[model samples]
Target: MEILGLACAAVLLFGAVLSIETRISRSDRQLARVERKLDLLLEHMGLQEHDPRLREVIELLRNGKKLYAIKRYRELTGAGLKEAKEAVERLG
Candidate 1:
């Protein structure tokens, strides 16, 4: 009976830990979404300079160097090539 009680307690503890971990993961995803939204809002408002690459990208785009802009954006932000391209395109 004592061993059974110990096993039950262990199971409960394991379940609780798993539940906590799951909640933490969900919260992290939600936080990331919120942060992304905030960044977009700031960018749209021109109220914050979140990334130094933005100016360079804009300049490159204005200079008709779209490829270079994408490359520079990727270098500065470490974003994927496609993402950098999309971001640069969005700037215009």
Candidate 2:
């Protein structure tokens, strides 16, 4: 009877540990997702890294003034449309 009780207690302890670990992992994932979303929002708002030149470029793109074409962006900033699009996407 004592042995059976010890085994049951051990099983309960193991289950509790597993449950806590799962909850912790889920919390970590949620925190990571929130951080990524904040980064994207800041970038879209042209607030990322606080570069005034980037803000000017973003403004030009927002006004449809065409500061640079896709190819030109690659030439100038070594970034593609994916990077350039982030600047203007928030304005719209």
Candidate 3:
């Protein structure tokens, strides 16, 4: 019947979608692992990536305005407040 056929089609479509999503989830996990390894490698090499705009944050930090430094870092990097504050602390 047409109803049965439509049900089968819907089930196939849903299975396809689930398969694609599972593949994507697996890929994401793999990418995260690779990135973590790369971060560790970079840390072991004692090399840090430099951003020119970090200078502005450093200046604000040196001026004793910690909150302003965090705000500037967040603005420059589009980072969250906690991340920006941690970065400012590391830089100082």
Candidate 4:
């Protein structure tokens, strides 16, 4: 009977820990999404200054290499293709 109780307690503890970890992971993802949205909002409002790396992207655009500019923006900002393309377009 004691052995069975111990096994049950261990199982409960493992489950609780797993549940907590899952909640934490979900919260972290939510927080990241919120942050990304905030960043986009700030950029749209022109409240966020251009990142220094964007200067290079602008130069690429001036050189008539728009695709390279978008690629470089994505590399520098970790932005998706559409986001990077929009950012490059905004530079012009």
Candidate 5:
């Protein structure tokens, strides 16, 4: 009986952890979807590809010129400008 109770407890704990992980993953996917939608909207508004300034900023970020990239992005996108700048600084 003791072993059975322990096994049941372990199973419940595992299930709870699995549920939380699944929820987190679902939320992450939803957030990604929203981000893609925003990216598309920005594209439609001509904020991507052709915008030399933004393109340059992204290039700098990709090349690890994070600080400069964030500064330029802040000056351009104005999306979470301060946080984005701080994130780049942290990344660097």
Candidate 6:
């Protein structure tokens, strides 16, 4: 009976965690949608600006320092390694 009680408690805790995770996932989606709309609005208003660090990345790439440029891009943009690599490739 005691073991069963502990198992039930564990199940309840798991369910609570799942519920929180679902809410967080939904919130993240909503935030992403809002950010996209804001970006579009800024673009429409001619207020969207490019990141200045992009120039530094370009310079690094031009100097044949591709690895350094990718690392710098990731740092400046908070992008993952693969995304940074792709972006650097695009710039190159």
Report the number of the highest-TM-score candidate: 6
lDDT of 1 by residue, 1-92 (tens): 99999999999999999999999999967876786688699879887554654888889999999999999898888876766776777776
Residue-level lDDT of model 3, residues 1-92, one tens digit each, is 99999999999999999999999999967876785577578779996657898988889889999999999898888866766776688688
Worst 10 residues of 3 by lDDT: 31-40
Model 5: CA > 4 A from native: 48-92
Q: Best candidate per lDDT, number?
A: 4
What would the per-residue lDDT of candidate 2 be over residues 37-75, giving only the tens digit for each residue? Answer: 887888788784554445556555666766453434445
- TM-scores vs. true structure, each candidate: 0.52, 0.52, 0.59, 0.51, 0.53, 0.61
What clash count goes with each model? 0, 0, 0, 0, 0, 0
lDDT of 6 at 42: 77
Off by over 4 Å in 4: 49-92
TM-score for model 5?
A: 0.53
Model 5 clash pairs are: none
Worst 10 residues of 1 by lDDT: 46-55
Q: Scored by Cα lDDT, where does model 6 land?
A: 0.85
Over the stretch 1-92, how does candidate 4's per-residue lDDT look in tens digits?
A: 99999999999999999999999999967876896688789878888656776898999999999999999999998977887887788786
Candidate 3 Cα errors over 4 Å, as ranges = 51-92
As for candidate 6, its clashing pairs are none
TM-score for candidate 4, residues paired by index: 0.51
Where in model 2 is the C-alpha error above 4 Å?
49-92
For residue 81, model 2's alpha carbon misses the true position, in angstroms, by: 27
Q: Rate residue 73 of model 5 by lDDT.
A: 72
Residue 79 in model 2: shift from native, Å? 26
Give the Cα error of residue 46 in candidate 1, in Å: 1.4
